[model samples]
Target: MTEKDIILTSEGREELEKELSNLINVIRPQVIEELVEARAQGDLSENADYDAARNRQAEVEARIKEIETMLSKAKIIEDSNNLNKEIKVGTTVTFQNLKTKKEMTVKIVGVIEADPFESKISNESPLAKAMLGKSTNDTCEVRELKEPYKILIKDIK
Candidate 1:
Protein backbone atom coordinates (compact mmCIF):
# COMPACT_ATOMS: atom_id res chain seq x y z
CA MET A 1 0.00 0.00 0.00
CA THR A 2 1.09 3.56 -0.69
CA GLU A 3 0.09 6.91 0.68
CA LYS A 4 -1.28 9.46 -1.73
CA ASP A 5 0.86 12.55 -2.26
CA ILE A 6 -0.34 15.75 -0.60
CA ILE A 7 -0.05 18.74 -2.92
CA LEU A 8 1.02 21.89 -1.12
CA THR A 9 2.29 25.31 -2.03
CA SER A 10 5.62 26.44 -0.56
CA GLU A 11 3.71 28.67 1.85
CA GLY A 12 1.52 25.76 2.89
CA ARG A 13 4.56 23.62 3.60
CA GLU A 14 6.05 26.44 5.70
CA GLU A 15 2.84 26.74 7.70
CA LEU A 16 2.75 23.00 8.35
CA GLU A 17 6.40 23.00 9.43
CA LYS A 18 5.76 25.90 11.81
CA GLU A 19 2.76 24.13 13.32
CA LEU A 20 4.72 20.90 13.75
CA SER A 21 7.50 22.80 15.48
CA ASN A 22 5.03 24.45 17.87
CA LEU A 23 3.38 21.13 18.63
CA ILE A 24 6.62 19.33 19.34
CA ASN A 25 8.44 22.10 21.20
CA VAL A 26 5.68 23.92 23.08
CA ILE A 27 2.41 21.98 23.18
CA ARG A 28 4.00 18.54 23.72
CA PRO A 29 5.88 19.77 26.81
CA GLN A 30 2.74 21.45 28.13
CA VAL A 31 0.75 18.25 27.70
CA ILE A 32 3.41 16.27 29.55
CA GLU A 33 3.40 18.78 32.42
CA GLU A 34 -0.40 18.62 32.59
CA LEU A 35 -0.30 14.82 32.77
CA VAL A 36 2.32 14.93 35.51
CA GLU A 37 0.31 17.44 37.51
CA ALA A 38 -2.91 15.44 37.08
CA ARG A 39 -1.14 12.24 38.18
CA ALA A 40 0.06 13.97 41.34
CA GLN A 41 -3.57 14.63 42.35
CA GLY A 42 -4.73 11.77 44.65
CA ASP A 43 -7.31 9.24 43.39
CA LEU A 44 -6.97 8.38 39.68
CA SER A 45 -10.46 6.82 39.67
CA GLU A 46 -12.32 10.10 40.35
CA ASN A 47 -9.79 12.47 38.79
CA ALA A 48 -11.37 14.56 36.02
CA ASP A 49 -8.11 16.42 35.50
CA TYR A 50 -6.30 13.16 34.85
CA ASP A 51 -8.87 12.11 32.24
CA ALA A 52 -8.79 15.53 30.56
CA ALA A 53 -5.03 15.60 30.50
CA ARG A 54 -4.87 12.10 29.01
CA ASN A 55 -7.37 13.09 26.35
CA ARG A 56 -5.39 16.20 25.48
CA GLN A 57 -2.21 14.16 25.25
CA ALA A 58 -3.83 11.69 22.90
CA GLU A 59 -5.16 14.46 20.66
CA VAL A 60 -1.82 16.23 20.52
CA GLU A 61 0.12 13.07 19.71
CA ALA A 62 -2.36 12.17 16.98
CA ARG A 63 -1.98 15.60 15.41
CA ILE A 64 1.80 15.31 15.55
CA LYS A 65 1.67 12.00 13.72
CA GLU A 66 -0.74 13.38 11.13
CA ILE A 67 1.47 16.37 10.45
CA GLU A 68 4.54 14.21 10.12
CA THR A 69 2.77 11.94 7.66
CA MET A 70 1.59 14.90 5.59
CA LEU A 71 5.04 16.39 5.53
CA SER A 72 6.55 13.11 4.44
CA LYS A 73 4.23 12.87 1.43
CA ALA A 74 4.08 16.55 0.64
CA LYS A 75 4.75 17.91 -2.85
CA ILE A 76 5.53 21.60 -2.86
CA ILE A 77 4.22 23.60 -5.80
CA GLU A 78 6.31 26.55 -6.92
CA ASP A 79 4.37 29.46 -8.38
CA SER A 80 5.43 31.12 -11.61
CA ASN A 81 3.38 34.28 -11.84
CA ASN A 82 4.08 35.36 -15.38
CA LEU A 83 1.50 37.96 -16.35
CA ASN A 84 -1.67 36.52 -17.90
CA LYS A 85 -0.20 33.02 -17.49
CA GLU A 86 -2.23 29.96 -16.66
CA ILE A 87 -3.72 29.86 -13.16
CA LYS A 88 -2.88 27.07 -10.76
CA VAL A 89 -2.24 26.34 -7.13
CA GLY A 90 -0.34 29.25 -5.48
CA THR A 91 -1.70 31.74 -7.97
CA THR A 92 -3.79 34.71 -6.93
CA VAL A 93 -6.64 35.12 -9.35
CA THR A 94 -9.08 37.95 -9.94
CA PHE A 95 -12.30 37.28 -11.75
CA GLN A 96 -15.66 38.93 -12.35
CA ASN A 97 -19.02 37.26 -12.33
CA LEU A 98 -20.77 37.82 -15.61
CA LYS A 99 -24.17 37.65 -13.97
CA THR A 100 -23.68 39.56 -10.71
CA LYS A 101 -20.95 41.79 -12.14
CA LYS A 102 -19.05 41.40 -8.87
CA GLU A 103 -15.29 41.18 -8.94
CA MET A 104 -13.52 38.88 -6.51
CA THR A 105 -9.93 37.94 -5.83
CA VAL A 106 -8.90 34.60 -4.39
CA LYS A 107 -5.72 32.66 -3.83
CA ILE A 108 -5.74 29.11 -5.11
CA VAL A 109 -4.19 26.78 -2.55
CA GLY A 110 -4.09 23.17 -1.44
CA VAL A 111 -6.87 21.53 0.57
CA ILE A 112 -5.03 21.86 3.88
CA GLU A 113 -4.47 25.61 3.44
CA ALA A 114 -7.88 26.55 2.07
CA ASP A 115 -9.58 29.26 4.11
CA PRO A 116 -12.57 30.94 2.57
CA PHE A 117 -12.51 33.65 5.22
CA GLU A 118 -9.04 34.55 4.00
CA SER A 119 -10.01 34.33 0.32
CA LYS A 120 -7.78 31.27 -0.12
CA ILE A 121 -9.74 28.69 -2.04
CA SER A 122 -8.95 25.01 -2.39
CA ASN A 123 -7.93 23.73 -5.81
CA GLU A 124 -10.62 21.06 -5.50
CA SER A 125 -13.28 23.75 -5.21
CA PRO A 126 -15.62 24.10 -8.18
CA LEU A 127 -14.59 27.69 -8.91
CA ALA A 128 -10.91 26.91 -8.65
CA LYS A 129 -11.36 23.76 -10.70
CA ALA A 130 -12.88 25.76 -13.51
CA MET A 131 -10.28 28.50 -13.34
CA LEU A 132 -7.15 26.31 -13.31
CA GLY A 133 -5.33 25.96 -16.64
CA LYS A 134 -7.16 29.07 -17.87
CA SER A 135 -5.45 32.42 -18.31
CA THR A 136 -6.51 36.01 -17.93
CA ASN A 137 -9.41 37.16 -20.12
CA ASP A 138 -10.61 33.57 -20.35
CA THR A 139 -14.17 32.77 -19.28
CA CYS A 140 -15.02 29.68 -17.29
CA GLU A 141 -18.25 28.29 -15.92
CA VAL A 142 -18.49 27.06 -12.35
CA ARG A 143 -21.15 24.60 -11.28
CA GLU A 144 -22.54 24.83 -7.79
CA LEU A 145 -25.51 23.28 -6.03
CA LYS A 146 -27.67 26.29 -6.79
CA GLU A 147 -26.79 27.17 -10.38
CA PRO A 148 -23.83 27.46 -12.69
CA TYR A 149 -22.26 30.87 -13.09
CA LYS A 150 -19.77 32.22 -15.62
CA ILE A 151 -16.72 34.22 -14.60
CA LEU A 152 -14.23 36.10 -16.71
CA ILE A 153 -10.68 36.04 -15.48
CA LYS A 154 -9.49 39.60 -15.04
CA ASP A 155 -5.99 38.98 -13.69
CA ILE A 156 -3.62 36.27 -12.53
CA LYS A 157 -0.70 37.07 -10.27
Candidate 2:
Protein backbone atom coordinates (compact mmCIF):
# COMPACT_ATOMS: atom_id res chain seq x y z
CA MET A 1 0.00 0.00 0.00
CA THR A 2 1.11 3.58 -0.58
CA GLU A 3 2.50 5.33 2.45
CA LYS A 4 -0.02 7.57 4.06
CA ASP A 5 0.95 11.20 4.56
CA ILE A 6 2.57 11.49 7.97
CA ILE A 7 0.75 14.11 9.99
CA LEU A 8 2.41 16.09 12.75
CA THR A 9 1.41 19.00 14.92
CA SER A 10 3.66 22.00 15.46
CA GLU A 11 4.83 20.66 18.81
CA GLY A 12 5.50 17.25 17.34
CA ARG A 13 7.40 18.75 14.48
CA GLU A 14 9.49 20.76 16.90
CA GLU A 15 10.18 17.62 18.90
CA LEU A 16 11.42 15.81 15.81
CA GLU A 17 13.56 18.76 14.83
CA LYS A 18 15.02 18.95 18.30
CA GLU A 19 15.87 15.26 18.24
CA LEU A 20 17.52 15.63 14.87
CA SER A 21 19.54 18.54 16.14
CA ASN A 22 20.66 16.61 19.18
CA LEU A 23 21.66 13.62 17.12
CA ILE A 24 23.67 15.74 14.75
CA ASN A 25 25.22 18.25 17.09
CA VAL A 26 25.77 16.30 20.30
CA ILE A 27 25.55 12.55 19.76
CA ARG A 28 27.43 12.50 16.50
CA PRO A 29 30.33 14.48 17.89
CA GLN A 30 30.53 12.25 20.97
CA VAL A 31 30.47 9.14 18.82
CA ILE A 32 33.19 10.54 16.58
CA GLU A 33 35.34 11.29 19.62
CA GLU A 34 34.83 7.74 20.87
CA LEU A 35 35.78 6.37 17.49
CA VAL A 36 38.92 8.46 17.49
CA GLU A 37 39.89 7.24 20.93
CA ALA A 38 39.13 3.63 20.00
CA ARG A 39 41.21 3.86 16.82
CA ALA A 40 44.13 5.13 18.87
CA GLN A 41 44.14 1.78 20.68
CA GLY A 42 45.36 0.13 17.43
CA ASP A 43 44.42 -3.58 17.12
CA LEU A 44 41.84 -3.59 14.29
CA SER A 45 40.67 -7.19 14.65
CA GLU A 46 40.12 -7.10 18.42
CA ASN A 47 38.87 -3.55 18.84
CA ALA A 48 35.48 -3.88 20.48
CA ASP A 49 35.36 -0.19 21.32
CA TYR A 50 36.00 0.73 17.71
CA ASP A 51 33.39 -1.74 16.51
CA ALA A 52 30.82 -0.50 18.99
CA ALA A 53 31.51 3.15 18.16
CA ARG A 54 31.21 2.48 14.43
CA ASN A 55 27.94 0.61 15.01
CA ARG A 56 26.60 3.48 17.06
CA GLN A 57 27.59 5.94 14.38
CA ALA A 58 25.80 3.85 11.79
CA GLU A 59 22.65 3.76 13.91
CA VAL A 60 22.76 7.49 14.58
CA GLU A 61 23.23 8.29 10.89
CA ALA A 62 20.38 5.97 10.01
CA ARG A 63 18.15 7.81 12.44
CA ILE A 64 19.23 11.13 10.96
CA LYS A 65 18.30 9.89 7.52
CA GLU A 66 14.91 8.72 8.70
CA ILE A 67 14.25 11.99 10.45
CA GLU A 68 15.28 13.96 7.37
CA THR A 69 12.96 11.90 5.24
CA MET A 70 10.09 12.45 7.62
CA LEU A 71 10.69 16.16 7.84
CA SER A 72 10.98 16.40 4.07
CA LYS A 73 7.59 14.78 3.63
CA ALA A 74 6.06 16.30 6.71
CA LYS A 75 2.45 17.34 6.49
CA ILE A 76 1.88 19.26 9.66
CA ILE A 77 -1.68 19.26 10.90
CA GLU A 78 -3.12 22.17 12.78
CA ASP A 79 -3.54 21.68 16.50
CA SER A 80 -6.93 21.94 18.18
CA ASN A 81 -6.54 25.62 18.93
CA ASN A 82 -9.47 26.71 16.84
CA LEU A 83 -11.23 23.41 16.48
CA ASN A 84 -14.87 23.36 17.36
CA LYS A 85 -16.88 20.34 18.49
CA GLU A 86 -15.28 17.95 16.04
CA ILE A 87 -13.01 15.01 16.48
CA LYS A 88 -9.67 15.78 14.87
CA VAL A 89 -5.99 15.35 15.30
CA GLY A 90 -4.56 16.86 18.53
CA THR A 91 -7.90 16.31 20.25
CA THR A 92 -8.16 14.19 23.37
CA VAL A 93 -11.14 11.91 23.03
CA THR A 94 -12.67 9.72 25.64
CA PHE A 95 -14.77 6.70 24.78
CA GLN A 96 -16.59 4.21 26.96
CA ASN A 97 -17.43 0.65 26.03
CA LEU A 98 -21.17 0.19 25.74
CA LYS A 99 -21.34 -3.49 26.61
CA THR A 100 -18.24 -4.11 28.73
CA LYS A 101 -18.27 -0.77 30.51
CA LYS A 102 -14.63 -0.14 29.73
CA GLU A 103 -13.31 3.35 29.18
CA MET A 104 -10.40 4.51 27.05
CA THR A 105 -8.94 7.92 26.41
CA VAL A 106 -7.10 8.34 23.15
CA LYS A 107 -5.41 11.28 21.53
CA ILE A 108 -5.57 11.20 17.76
CA VAL A 109 -2.20 12.31 16.40
CA GLY A 110 0.14 12.10 13.45
CA VAL A 111 1.50 8.70 12.49
CA ILE A 112 4.96 9.66 13.74
CA GLU A 113 3.71 10.59 17.21
CA ALA A 114 1.51 7.57 17.66
CA ASP A 115 2.27 5.64 20.83
CA PRO A 116 -0.41 3.12 21.62
CA PHE A 117 1.06 2.43 25.04
CA GLU A 118 0.64 6.11 25.83
CA SER A 119 -2.91 6.12 24.47
CA LYS A 120 -1.92 8.19 21.46
CA ILE A 121 -3.35 6.44 18.41
CA SER A 122 -2.63 7.24 14.81
CA ASN A 123 -5.45 8.50 12.69
CA GLU A 124 -4.92 5.41 10.57
CA SER A 125 -5.76 2.94 13.33
CA PRO A 126 -9.07 1.08 13.02
CA LEU A 127 -10.38 2.71 16.18
CA ALA A 128 -9.35 6.19 15.06
CA LYS A 129 -10.78 5.58 11.63
CA ALA A 130 -14.13 4.71 13.15
CA MET A 131 -14.00 7.60 15.59
CA LEU A 132 -13.25 10.30 13.03
CA GLY A 133 -16.12 12.55 12.13
CA LYS A 134 -18.10 11.06 15.01
CA SER A 135 -19.52 13.35 17.66
CA THR A 136 -20.25 12.95 21.33
CA ASN A 137 -22.90 10.38 22.25
CA ASP A 138 -22.24 8.49 19.00
CA THR A 139 -21.30 4.82 19.20
CA CYS A 140 -18.80 2.98 17.05
CA GLU A 141 -17.68 -0.61 16.90
CA VAL A 142 -14.15 -1.89 16.99
CA ARG A 143 -13.55 -5.29 15.44
CA GLU A 144 -10.81 -7.22 17.09
CA LEU A 145 -9.70 -10.86 16.87
CA LYS A 146 -11.87 -12.13 19.67
CA GLU A 147 -15.04 -10.05 19.56
CA PRO A 148 -16.46 -6.79 18.31
CA TYR A 149 -17.04 -4.16 20.94
CA LYS A 150 -18.96 -0.91 20.80
CA ILE A 151 -17.70 2.37 22.23
CA LEU A 152 -19.56 5.55 22.85
CA ILE A 153 -17.78 8.85 22.46
CA LYS A 154 -18.19 10.33 25.91
CA ASP A 155 -16.29 13.55 25.45
CA ILE A 156 -13.84 15.38 23.26
CA LYS A 157 -11.43 18.14 24.21
Candidate 3:
Protein backbone atom coordinates (compact mmCIF):
# COMPACT_ATOMS: atom_id res chain seq x y z
CA MET A 1 0.00 0.00 0.00
CA THR A 2 1.11 3.52 -0.78
CA GLU A 3 1.48 6.01 2.04
CA LYS A 4 -0.34 9.32 1.64
CA ASP A 5 1.77 12.45 1.50
CA ILE A 6 1.76 14.60 4.65
CA ILE A 7 1.74 18.31 3.78
CA LEU A 8 3.70 20.71 5.96
CA THR A 9 5.03 24.24 5.74
CA SER A 10 8.77 24.92 5.98
CA GLU A 11 8.41 26.06 9.58
CA GLY A 12 6.34 23.03 10.44
CA ARG A 13 8.95 20.71 8.93
CA GLU A 14 11.67 22.48 10.91
CA GLU A 15 9.72 22.07 14.12
CA LEU A 16 9.30 18.37 13.47
CA GLU A 17 12.98 18.03 12.72
CA LYS A 18 13.86 19.78 15.96
CA GLU A 19 11.54 17.50 17.90
CA LEU A 20 12.98 14.42 16.25
CA SER A 21 16.50 15.57 17.02
CA ASN A 22 15.62 16.19 20.68
CA LEU A 23 14.07 12.76 20.98
CA ILE A 24 17.04 11.04 19.41
CA ASN A 25 19.89 13.02 20.96
CA VAL A 26 18.46 13.95 24.37
CA ILE A 27 15.33 12.05 25.44
CA ARG A 28 16.51 8.68 24.14
CA PRO A 29 19.78 8.87 26.05
CA GLN A 30 18.05 10.12 29.19
CA VAL A 31 15.62 7.22 29.06
CA ILE A 32 18.47 4.81 28.61
CA GLU A 33 20.26 6.20 31.65
CA GLU A 34 17.07 5.97 33.66
CA LEU A 35 16.68 2.34 32.64
CA VAL A 36 20.24 1.57 33.70
CA GLU A 37 19.77 3.24 37.08
CA ALA A 38 16.48 1.48 37.64
CA ARG A 39 17.95 -1.91 36.73
CA ALA A 40 20.78 -1.43 39.25
CA GLN A 41 18.16 -1.20 42.04
CA GLY A 42 17.59 -5.00 41.79
CA ASP A 43 14.44 -6.94 42.88
CA LEU A 44 13.12 -7.31 39.33
CA SER A 45 9.55 -8.36 40.26
CA GLU A 46 8.77 -5.48 42.62
CA ASN A 47 10.92 -2.71 41.14
CA ALA A 48 8.69 0.33 40.64
CA ASP A 49 11.48 2.47 39.24
CA TYR A 50 12.30 -0.14 36.61
CA ASP A 51 8.63 -0.43 35.63
CA ALA A 52 8.26 3.33 35.32
CA ALA A 53 11.44 3.62 33.28
CA ARG A 54 10.30 0.86 30.93
CA ASN A 55 6.94 2.60 30.43
CA ARG A 56 8.64 5.89 29.71
CA GLN A 57 11.00 4.20 27.29
CA ALA A 58 8.03 2.74 25.43
CA GLU A 59 6.41 6.15 25.12
CA VAL A 60 9.55 7.83 23.86
CA GLU A 61 10.24 5.10 21.33
CA ALA A 62 6.66 5.23 20.05
CA ARG A 63 6.83 8.98 19.59
CA ILE A 64 10.15 8.68 17.77
CA LYS A 65 8.69 6.15 15.36
CA GLU A 66 5.65 8.29 14.73
CA ILE A 67 7.76 11.35 13.98
CA GLU A 68 10.03 9.38 11.69
CA THR A 69 7.06 8.12 9.71
CA MET A 70 5.62 11.58 9.41
CA LEU A 71 8.92 13.02 8.26
CA SER A 72 9.34 10.26 5.73
CA LYS A 73 5.99 11.12 4.19
CA ALA A 74 6.29 14.87 4.53
CA LYS A 75 5.82 17.15 1.52
CA ILE A 76 6.97 20.66 2.34
CA ILE A 77 4.96 23.61 1.03
CA GLU A 78 7.29 26.27 -0.32
CA ASP A 79 6.39 29.92 -0.43
CA SER A 80 5.99 31.31 -3.95
CA ASN A 81 6.74 34.88 -4.99
CA ASN A 82 4.71 34.62 -8.17
CA LEU A 83 1.26 33.20 -7.59
CA ASN A 84 -0.37 35.24 -10.33
CA LYS A 85 -2.45 37.26 -7.84
CA GLU A 86 -4.28 34.11 -6.75
CA ILE A 87 -4.80 33.04 -3.16
CA LYS A 88 -3.01 29.75 -2.41
CA VAL A 89 -1.00 27.97 0.22
CA GLY A 90 1.77 30.07 1.76
CA THR A 91 -0.04 33.30 0.80
CA THR A 92 -0.94 35.82 3.45
CA VAL A 93 -4.37 37.17 2.60
CA THR A 94 -6.34 40.14 3.85
CA PHE A 95 -10.09 40.08 3.51
CA GLN A 96 -12.94 42.29 4.63
CA ASN A 97 -16.28 40.98 5.82
CA LEU A 98 -18.81 42.46 3.43
CA LYS A 99 -21.53 42.71 6.07
CA THR A 100 -19.52 43.55 9.20
CA LYS A 101 -16.82 45.55 7.41
CA LYS A 102 -14.23 43.86 9.63
CA GLU A 103 -10.89 43.12 8.03
CA MET A 104 -8.63 40.22 9.00
CA THR A 105 -5.40 38.83 7.66
CA VAL A 106 -4.35 35.19 7.76
CA LYS A 107 -1.69 33.04 6.18
CA ILE A 108 -2.92 30.04 4.28
CA VAL A 109 -0.86 26.92 5.05
CA GLY A 110 -0.95 23.16 5.02
CA VAL A 111 -2.90 21.28 7.68
CA ILE A 112 0.15 20.54 9.83
CA GLU A 113 0.98 24.22 10.10
CA ALA A 114 -2.54 25.47 10.73
CA ASP A 115 -2.84 27.40 13.98
CA PRO A 116 -5.83 29.66 14.38
CA PHE A 117 -4.23 31.36 17.35
CA GLU A 118 -1.30 32.32 15.14
CA SER A 119 -3.55 33.56 12.34
CA LYS A 120 -2.46 30.65 10.09
CA ILE A 121 -5.29 28.79 8.47
CA SER A 122 -5.33 25.40 6.76
CA ASN A 123 -5.95 25.39 3.04
CA GLU A 124 -8.61 22.77 3.57
CA SER A 125 -10.65 25.03 5.81
CA PRO A 126 -13.97 26.35 4.52
CA LEU A 127 -12.83 29.97 4.31
CA ALA A 128 -9.52 29.11 2.71
CA LYS A 129 -11.18 26.71 0.27
CA ALA A 130 -13.59 29.43 -0.81
CA MET A 131 -10.72 31.89 -1.28
CA LEU A 132 -8.28 29.59 -3.07
CA GLY A 133 -7.68 30.44 -6.72
CA LYS A 134 -9.48 33.77 -6.21
CA SER A 135 -7.76 37.06 -6.99
CA THR A 136 -7.80 40.34 -5.13
CA ASN A 137 -11.17 42.15 -5.08
CA ASP A 138 -12.97 38.81 -5.50
CA THR A 139 -15.81 37.87 -3.18
CA CYS A 140 -15.84 34.50 -1.45
CA GLU A 141 -18.58 32.72 0.48
CA VAL A 142 -17.67 30.94 3.70
CA ARG A 143 -19.80 27.81 3.58
CA GLU A 144 -18.93 26.53 7.04
CA LEU A 145 -21.04 29.12 8.85
CA LYS A 146 -24.74 28.76 9.56
CA GLU A 147 -25.34 31.89 7.53
CA PRO A 148 -22.64 31.82 4.91
CA TYR A 149 -20.73 35.06 5.14
CA LYS A 150 -19.27 36.84 2.14
CA ILE A 151 -15.77 38.28 2.26
CA LEU A 152 -13.98 40.50 -0.22
CA ILE A 153 -10.33 39.84 -0.84
CA LYS A 154 -8.44 43.01 -0.13
CA ASP A 155 -4.83 41.96 -0.47
CA ILE A 156 -2.53 39.00 -1.05
CA LYS A 157 1.12 38.64 -0.24
Candidate 4:
Protein backbone atom coordinates (compact mmCIF):
# COMPACT_ATOMS: atom_id res chain seq x y z
CA MET A 1 0.00 0.00 0.00
CA THR A 2 1.10 3.54 -0.70
CA GLU A 3 1.38 6.14 2.05
CA LYS A 4 0.10 9.69 1.74
CA ASP A 5 2.68 12.35 1.01
CA ILE A 6 3.89 14.16 4.14
CA ILE A 7 4.28 17.92 3.67
CA LEU A 8 7.40 19.34 5.28
CA THR A 9 9.60 22.43 5.27
CA SER A 10 13.36 22.23 4.78
CA GLU A 11 13.89 22.60 8.52
CA GLY A 12 11.36 19.88 9.24
CA ARG A 13 13.09 17.58 6.77
CA GLU A 14 16.43 18.30 8.42
CA GLU A 15 15.02 17.50 11.85
CA LEU A 16 13.67 14.14 10.65
CA GLU A 17 16.98 13.27 8.96
CA LYS A 18 18.86 14.18 12.14
CA GLU A 19 16.58 11.95 14.23
CA LEU A 20 16.92 9.07 11.75
CA SER A 21 20.71 9.42 11.76
CA ASN A 22 20.82 9.40 15.57
CA LEU A 23 18.66 6.28 15.75
CA ILE A 24 20.70 4.45 13.14
CA ASN A 25 24.22 5.53 14.13
CA VAL A 26 24.04 6.11 17.88
CA ILE A 27 20.90 4.68 19.53
CA ARG A 28 20.98 1.42 17.60
CA PRO A 29 24.58 0.72 18.55
CA GLN A 30 23.98 1.65 22.19
CA VAL A 31 20.95 -0.63 22.36
CA ILE A 32 22.91 -3.45 20.79
CA GLU A 33 25.61 -3.02 23.44
CA GLU A 34 22.98 -3.06 26.16
CA LEU A 35 21.51 -6.26 24.74
CA VAL A 36 24.98 -7.85 24.64
CA GLU A 37 25.66 -6.91 28.25
CA ALA A 38 22.24 -8.18 29.31
CA ARG A 39 22.85 -11.52 27.55
CA ALA A 40 26.12 -11.92 29.48
CA GLN A 41 24.14 -11.89 32.76
CA GLY A 42 22.86 -15.49 32.10
CA ASP A 43 19.16 -16.55 32.21
CA LEU A 44 16.90 -14.21 30.18
CA SER A 45 13.61 -15.23 31.92
CA GLU A 46 14.19 -13.46 35.25
CA ASN A 47 16.47 -10.74 33.88
CA ALA A 48 14.90 -7.25 34.15
CA ASP A 49 17.89 -5.76 32.34
CA TYR A 50 17.41 -8.18 29.46
CA ASP A 51 13.69 -7.36 29.13
CA ALA A 52 14.38 -3.61 29.28
CA ALA A 53 17.08 -3.85 26.65
CA ARG A 54 14.83 -5.91 24.38
CA ASN A 55 12.03 -3.40 24.79
CA ARG A 56 14.36 -0.52 24.00
CA GLN A 57 15.58 -2.35 20.90
CA ALA A 58 12.03 -2.84 19.68
CA GLU A 59 11.12 0.82 20.25
CA VAL A 60 14.23 2.11 18.50
CA GLU A 61 13.70 -0.18 15.52
CA ALA A 62 10.04 0.81 15.25
CA ARG A 63 10.93 4.50 15.31
CA ILE A 64 13.64 4.00 12.73
CA LYS A 65 11.14 2.36 10.39
CA GLU A 66 8.56 5.06 10.97
CA ILE A 67 11.04 7.84 10.26
CA GLU A 68 12.29 6.12 7.16
CA THR A 69 8.76 5.76 5.84
CA MET A 70 7.97 9.39 6.52
CA LEU A 71 11.16 10.56 4.89
CA SER A 72 10.48 8.44 1.85
CA LYS A 73 7.06 10.03 1.39
CA ALA A 74 8.01 13.56 2.40
CA LYS A 75 7.25 16.45 -0.03
CA ILE A 76 9.16 19.51 0.98
CA ILE A 77 7.33 22.87 0.71
CA GLU A 78 9.77 25.33 -0.76
CA ASP A 79 9.88 29.04 0.06
CA SER A 80 8.11 31.28 -2.45
CA ASN A 81 8.94 34.81 -3.54
CA ASN A 82 5.24 35.74 -3.78
CA LEU A 83 4.71 35.52 -0.02
CA ASN A 84 4.30 39.29 0.28
CA LYS A 85 1.28 39.23 -2.06
CA GLU A 86 -0.82 36.38 -0.65
CA ILE A 87 -1.09 33.91 2.21
CA LYS A 88 0.63 30.63 1.57
CA VAL A 89 2.76 28.04 3.30
CA GLY A 90 5.82 29.63 4.98
CA THR A 91 4.08 33.02 5.12
CA THR A 92 3.61 34.90 8.36
CA VAL A 93 0.05 36.28 8.47
CA THR A 94 -1.43 38.93 10.67
CA PHE A 95 -5.18 38.91 11.21
CA GLN A 96 -7.81 40.58 13.34
CA ASN A 97 -10.67 38.81 15.08
CA LEU A 98 -13.83 40.70 14.18
CA LYS A 99 -15.79 39.68 17.27
CA THR A 100 -13.19 39.90 20.01
CA LYS A 101 -11.26 42.68 18.32
CA LYS A 102 -7.99 40.90 18.87
CA GLU A 103 -5.05 40.95 16.49
CA MET A 104 -2.74 37.98 16.07
CA THR A 105 0.02 36.78 13.83
CA VAL A 106 0.70 33.20 12.80
CA LYS A 107 3.13 31.50 10.50
CA ILE A 108 1.58 28.99 8.12
CA VAL A 109 3.74 25.87 7.79
CA GLY A 110 3.53 22.26 6.80
CA VAL A 111 2.11 19.80 9.36
CA ILE A 112 5.55 18.55 10.39
CA GLU A 113 6.68 22.07 11.34
CA ALA A 114 3.54 23.32 13.08
CA ASP A 115 3.74 24.39 16.72
CA PRO A 116 0.53 25.94 18.01
CA PHE A 117 2.19 27.48 21.05
CA GLU A 118 4.55 29.37 18.79
CA SER A 119 1.67 30.57 16.55
CA LYS A 120 2.82 28.34 13.71
CA ILE A 121 -0.21 26.62 12.19
CA SER A 122 -0.38 23.81 9.65
CA ASN A 123 -1.81 24.56 6.20
CA GLU A 124 -4.30 21.76 6.80
CA SER A 125 -5.76 23.52 9.82
CA PRO A 126 -9.18 25.15 9.43
CA LEU A 127 -8.01 28.72 9.94
CA ALA A 128 -5.06 28.31 7.63
CA LYS A 129 -7.21 26.64 4.99
CA ALA A 130 -9.63 29.52 5.04
CA MET A 131 -6.82 32.04 4.82
CA LEU A 132 -4.77 30.34 2.12
CA GLY A 133 -4.54 32.23 -1.18
CA LYS A 134 -6.12 35.31 0.39
CA SER A 135 -4.38 38.66 0.07
CA THR A 136 -4.09 41.44 2.63
CA ASN A 137 -7.44 42.94 3.82
CA ASP A 138 -9.39 39.87 2.75
CA THR A 139 -11.98 38.49 5.20
CA CYS A 140 -12.19 34.82 6.02
CA GLU A 141 -14.45 32.70 8.18
CA VAL A 142 -13.19 30.20 10.74
CA ARG A 143 -15.55 27.33 9.97
CA GLU A 144 -14.17 24.95 12.58
CA LEU A 145 -15.62 26.96 15.44
CA LYS A 146 -19.17 26.28 16.64
CA GLU A 147 -19.96 29.92 16.08
CA PRO A 148 -18.07 30.92 13.00
CA TYR A 149 -15.71 33.81 13.51
CA LYS A 150 -14.59 36.30 10.89
CA ILE A 151 -10.95 37.25 10.63
CA LEU A 152 -9.63 40.12 8.59
CA ILE A 153 -6.30 39.52 6.96
CA LYS A 154 -4.07 42.40 7.98
CA ASP A 155 -0.77 41.54 6.40
CA ILE A 156 1.18 38.77 4.71
CA LYS A 157 4.93 38.46 4.73
By TM-score, who's the top model here?
1
Runs off by more than 4 Å, candidate 2 = 1-4, 82-84
**Over all chains combined, what TM-score does candidate 4 have?**
0.91
TM-score order of candidates, top first: 1, 4, 2, 3
Q: What is the lDDT, from 0 to 100, of the residue 51 in candidate 1?
A: 99
Residue 11 lDDT in model 3?
83
- The number of the candidate with the highest lDDT is 1
* Global CA lDDT computed for model 1: 0.93
Flag regions of model 3 displaced more than 4 Å.
none
Compared with the true structure, what per-residue lDDT tens digits does model 2 show for residues 121-144? 988788888888888899888776
Per-residue lDDT over 1-157 for candidate 4, one digit per residue giving the tens place of the 0 to 100 score: 2567988877788989999999999999999999999999999999999999999999999999988888899888776777358888888899999999999999998887899999999999999999999999999999885778999999888
Model 4 residue 117 distance off true place after TM-score fit, in angstroms: 1.8
Of 3 and 4, which scores higher on TM-score?
4
lDDT per model vs. reference? 0.93, 0.88, 0.90, 0.91
- Model 4 gets an lDDT of 0.91
Between candidates 1 and 2, the lDDT winner: 1
Q: For candidate 1, write residues 19-60 as lDDT tens digits.
A: 999999999999999999999998999999999999999999
Candidate 3 has its poorest 10 consecutive residues by lDDT at: 1-10
- Per-candidate TM equals 0.94, 0.90, 0.89, 0.91
Give per-residue lDDT, candidate 4, residue 145: 56
